[model samples]
Target chain A: MSILEATRLVKRFGPVTAVNDVSLTVGEGEVVALLGPNGAGKSTTLHMVLGLITPDSGSIVLFGQELARHRVEVLSRINFAASYVDLPGALRVHEVLDAFARMYAVRRPRERVAELVELFELGPLAKRKVMTLSSGQRTRVQLAKALLNRPRLLVLDEPTANLDPDAGDRIRGLLSALARQDGSAMLITSHNMREVERMCDRICFMSHGLIVASGSAKELAGHYGAEDLEEVFLKVARG
Target chain B: MTAATPPSAPQALTLPPLSLAARRMRIMGVVRRDFAALRRSPMRMFEVLFWPTVELLLWGFVTLFLQTQRVPFVVTFLLGAVLLWQVLQKASNEISIAFLEDIWSRNLLNVQVCPLSSVEYLLGLVLFSLGKVAFAVAVMAGLAFALYGFGVTGLGVGLVPFVGLLLVLGWSLGLVGIAAVLRFGENAQVIAWSLVFVVQPLAGIFYPISVLPAPLRTVAWFLPASHVFEGMRTVMAGGAVPWDRMAWAAALNAVYLAATLALFAGALRYARRHGRLSRFGD
Candidate 1:
């Protein structure tokens, strides 16, 4: 079953069309990657999906309900995280998670927060203010926040962008496990081709506000007559 | 690689509907986040308690000096005005500051993405402001009684309506400030702090509306705060509670509050359409 269905989404800012006629979907337990170069409208598309931006013309259905009509109800079942956004800097790690847990109406918030703290190895940093954490530690906290509700569909924008290699690899492994074990669908955007190849079930390449090609890693490489996904990305981005 | 076969249709996950109790919990969650910050930051705690005390002391002394000149106004009248004016200031300032804190911390987007509706989030801000206003008022009232022997309770039952009207007016102005920031971004943050002052003189915080020039008096007539302060003066002058003026203030507040709420909703729509919400802090 498709967890999200965004059809023919079009968003324009002034004279520039940021996302033009984009249609995308993510099925249950499937991890879909939206890969594009700068200004290719990936963020704009993700923003629309997250309900942070209103599309000029489009429709979004999440979990078999229209997002526009059932926004509050639908949104309660989904969550999002991004490297560019920060949690409250003054709040301690546990405080931030606990607050969000209550906001999401999670049952037994304290237990849920404790479980996430252990899952992310945040026990040592739980008492530290968010501003005091390193970039890698913050990333872990953010991911932990994203899972507070056990959202059926998770949207991530450069989830591992700020993490060190070891931390980044562990995050990828954990996210893949969540998709396979818990059947949580995800829509992610990343600039790292190898990370995309390892985690994403399918990749969609976008350029200049439009998706130019979409396939599995190997199929995209063959379709673009390139040796790998990185070369395919270069071909699509340059065109 | 070929496309993986799609999973067969599974049972849709059941999501609980948002009950009134649940919505209230979420609103309190917003308030809790703010209180947690205030508890951790000494400067924030000082801001809540210290500034109001200082303002009371400064104004209390000025009122005492004025009493020596045998002015027409009693010490209670002047000191009472100072105390009441702080309520209005705190109500408006705290609301705007609450919103701005989320923006500064880049947490606005995080909150917006959750199930909390815009109405819920706004109510949270208002409730949090009311809490802060209550604490500030208590502190100032106590200091006034101890240092100047002036009691806010001297206004009798009239104080209730007076403070209520001022609070509504403050909320209206605060919503306008929030709308301005939404439409114009952080550059318009000056509106949050300055808008209340713009209405301060017109509302006759320290003087009677009659003292204003003809043109300004006409403008002040429409302001609910002006009517509130005028009613307050009437009570302090040993007259009836001025129900007519209280009614006028309530009626005017209804209109202004409605208009500001609409303005805020429109500004939020504009932000969403333009994608400003995603890049608000940046």
Candidate 2:
């Protein structure tokens, strides 16, 4: 079964439709990338799926249950991270992690926090307040928070946007590994096509509140008669 | 180190959804996090203490001078009004500012996305404010006793119902501030600090409601705090507990509280509908 199925979803803010009939799916253990330029409604669609916003029309089903009917139940098994949303800066890193662990009610919260702390390489930084951390460090902390629940469905928005190349590559590797884990599916939105190629099993290119094209890297390249997904994206985006 | 094996198509974790007990724990977790932040920052804690302390000291001296002038009901009229007003202001401001703290720190989006429902989040703020009020009230009351020889304990157990109604009124005002912040964002932050006092003139706290001009007295009669303050005057004037007035205050507070909560819910729905929730900090 798909972990997330958003069907015929539409959201409008006054005259501008943020997401228009955007239907998509992320199957069990699959990693899908939603690629779009700014204002393509990628973030808006993600917000609707997160139950942070209500779509004007259509439905979202996560884990075989309708979101409208069972949002809190569905949300308990899902986690989201974005650079735009942040943990409280006054809090120490481990304190923030521990607090979320308790909120998510993870089994063996202390052990889970310890494991994530080690996995995120946050040992030395754990005691410091989140405000003291650099941007790259904050991204790692957000990623750790997203993983705190061992969520079955993980949604990330521009997860590695501001990191240095090494940190970005490390995050891509970590996410790739997590996506490969059993019982988990991921949906990521990013502007970086190379990162999409490295991490996603399928790509949905969005523009002006619509999914204009969708395919794997090789398929998209061959379809567009291009060198790679980037060129395919350039063709689809500009056209 | 061994090479990593690819994950098989295994069964999903299928952890049971959060029970009521788990949800309560989540609320406590939020409260604990907020309390811990307040604990670490002595300045923020002092910010909560500073206003009430200053208000009490300022009025304590006034009441001391009034006693020499032999003002009528000096204990109940001036000291009582100031102390109770402090409780109302402290409770309302504490809860309203707690909501803003999440917004200023850009943490509201994260908290909202979790399994925490809007009601649960509101309850957490209320719980956190309860702690703040309890601590502040104790400190203020102690200082009133030491400085002016008047304290809440002087009212005996009659204090319970009075404090309860005042808190409900405060929560009502606090929720209105929360609704404003959600709808109008940071530009509306001033509402959190000043909304309650906008009704102060009509509340008839220091003076009796009869002292107001006819039209203003009509407005004052609608305020729950007016009834509570009048009840305080009644108690000081050798009357009974003023159960009828207390009942009126509680009833008015009930309607106000319900309306405030409804407005809060509607404001949240508006924020989500317009995509303002994420941009609230901006």
Interface RMSD of each: 6.2, 3.4
**Each candidate: RMSD to true structure?**
3.8, 2.5
C-alpha DockQ for predicted model 2: 0.51
Residue ranges of candidate 2 with Cα displaced over 4 Å: B1-15
What local lDDT score does residue B51 receive in model 2, on the 0 to 100 scale? 86
Residues B160-230 of candidate 2: C-alpha lDDT, one tens digit per residue:
78888888899889999989988887788899889989877888888889999999998887888988888
Question: Which portions of model 1 show Cα errors greater than 4 Å?
Answer: B1-15
Q: Please state the CAPRI-style docking class of candidate 2.
A: medium
The window of 10 residues in a row where model 1 chain A has the poorest summed lDDT is: A103-112
What is the Å distance of residue B30 in model 1 from its true position?
A: 0.4
The lDDT for every candidate, in the order shown, is: 0.87, 0.83
User: Per-residue lDDT of A1-239 in model 2, one digit per residue for the tens?
Assistant: 88999999999989998899999999998899998778999999999999888899999999999987887788888999997877888888888888887677565566777777888889999899988999889999999999887788899999999788889988888877776754578999988888999998999989999998888988888888999888887887788
lDDT per residue as tens, model 1, A68-181: 889888888888989999998888999999888878876566877887787788999999999999988998999988987788889999999999888898889888876786
* Per-residue C-alpha lDDT of model 1 across residues B85-124, encoded as one tens digit per residue: 8888888889999999989999888998989988998998
